[model samples]
Target: MNQDNRYVICMKWGSKYPAEYVNRLYNMVKRHLTLDFQMVCLTDDTTGINPDIKCYPIPELNLPANLPERGWKKLTTFKPELYDLKGTALFLDIDIVIVDNIDCFFTYNAKHEDSVVIIRDWKKPWRMVGNSSVYRFKIGQNTYPKLLTYFEQNFEKIRQEVRHEQAFLSNYLREHHHLEYWDSSWCVSFKYHCLQKIPLAYFIPPKKPSGAKIIVFHGEINPPDAITGGGGKWYRHVLPSEWIKAAWQ
Candidate 1:
């Protein structure tokens, strides 16, 4: 592995998100990330993806038919020989929008190469839950073999015991004392950290929290909805955000 190689990885399978999201993400990453790196997208369809971004077929999980797909699909990235990629990898969810410079995500705690660094789940501060929207790990390291093996060997048991991929990953890293969190200000949730308090949310559009590098659209509020002002549920209301559009671009 080249000592300078850095990778930003994302996965897309089902048709929930379009290829434009991946293309936009590649552009955003290119704009914000100062390092010399490659953007890898694991997807079933690459028809409209930007040619600059490397696209690969989703790794095989070999999950049982009865198991639900939801978050479990992300585990495919843990394949020991993942797309022949090695070195540092930062995984970003398709819905996240990059804001400020993301150089810190790669440089911070560079010495701690063995720990799996992930954003802390905003809602579950007390529990050892990690929001996998953005996480950093070395390819073929730690969980690749350890947690992957655990899931494979205990396929039936995991199907019953774990609720989702993040849950299993969080607990596995917690047990191994390998779970590390990025600074709270680096990666924040759009709903929890940026949205205005309840009633104010209706009149006020979301703003980027100070020092936040990435805004994760967890649960609801996709980038398209935020741009078009269409992501409103009965309880939560989101006003159109031009700033979000600029950042997402």
Candidate 2:
């Protein structure tokens, strides 16, 4: 693979995630990959990040500044003028762990001609597409303007229709045929792949998948809170301490 053609991309904003998470992800990628690749973080702050990472500012979206903080920020991935990136870029959430080599994610593509490739949620079988937790795309293609346009025209409709960006992407891509669901083994759900909770100590922790390349912390459970098992009242109190230790170390 050409060194210049690959990228590991992530985003961060607000106090929820620390800058070190981005740095740690860079370390994980470097430790696991044999090929030369750039690890880029599109963030609002650069302090505390490793020098190896190319930090870029999070692009402004069409949404209002006063809007409540939700997962909609992820939709910026589709903005053409914002990112202005190129080549095969793998988008990973800051809350995941890289257990196996993720170099293959860039190589895989849809059978048809499409710019975006993602994974289908196994639980929601009827849905044509899945969450965008881990996805690959060619920058500047502007393959996702329809999503932005939809939000622009039907903001209230969307607010009532779906709760997050993933839901919008799933529906929009399903209509356009630009969506491709990846193999289940490539990305596994944390709840399904690891333990939810321990009977005693409330601290037995979760287990990592045998050969899973990426374990995504979707929904309410994230890395920091997952480690402490202290997200909120509705969240499950499962800590994947062993998995986190093995993958990050």
Candidate 3:
């Protein structure tokens, strides 16, 4: 496997996000990443996806039917030898907008052999957690087999214990002392960091934070909603911005 090559991976399953989400994400990534890389979309429907994007069926987790589907499928990314994807892999959620150069995400900790790198969850203040909107690891490396095996064995107990997949993975890494965080400024939350005060949000459309490579849309304010001011709630608001239109294009 060539170390120079970067593999960017993302998944799309249900109708919550359309094929356009994947297409927009690919364009944003191309505009931002200045590296030799291939973008892979693990998806169930590829009807409207671009021809250039490498599409593969979403890897099955084989979890019980009772288990919630929210973020459980992401666990498949940890499976050893996932689709034989090689080199450093950076996982980006389809909802994210690339705002700056992301060349460093692949090379930041190249010297460290087996560490899980992720964004510090902006919502969690008391305990350390990884947001997982953007994260990096070597494909097929199996950096934390014990954690993966444990989750598989104790699927029910782990699900009952943690709030979600990100929390469970965070606890696993934190316990093992192998979890590291990208600079807080690099991957920022749109709801919290971008638009803090409700009144101010009405006047000033969200701006790209300094040194931010990716702007994450964790909750209700997705890129489309942000652009059209269709944000769900009163507190969760955004002014229309031409920049978002260009970035999403």
Kindly list the per-residue Cα lDDT of model 2 for residues 1-249, writing each as its tens digit. 332477888999988888878887888888877876788888898989888888888877766568787678777767754454666678888888888987678767567655478877767768665777888876556556566777667877887888778888778776875778778888888766665543532656666767788888776767665565556333355653755766763
Worst 10 residues of 1 by lDDT: 140-149
- Quantify how close model 3 is to the true structure by its C-alpha RMSD in Å: 1.8
Q: What's the count of clashing pairs in each model shown?
A: 0, 0, 0
Candidate 1 structure quality by residue, lDDT tens digits, 66-179: 555667777777676786687788999988999888988889784455677888878868877888889888785434566777777787886677677887888877776478
lDDT of 3 by residue, 223-245 (tens): 88878876757886787766667
Model 3 lDDT on a 0 to 1 scale? 0.80
- TM-score against truth, every candidate: 0.93, 0.85, 0.93
Q: Rank the candidates by lDDT, best first.
A: 1, 3, 2
Lowest-scoring 10 consecutive residues by lDDT in candidate 3?
Answer: 61-70
- Give the winner by lDDT: 1 or 3: 1
How good is model 1 by TM-score? 0.93
Question: Which candidate achieves the best lDDT against the true structure?
Answer: 1
Superposed model 1: Cα runs more than 4 Å off:
141-143
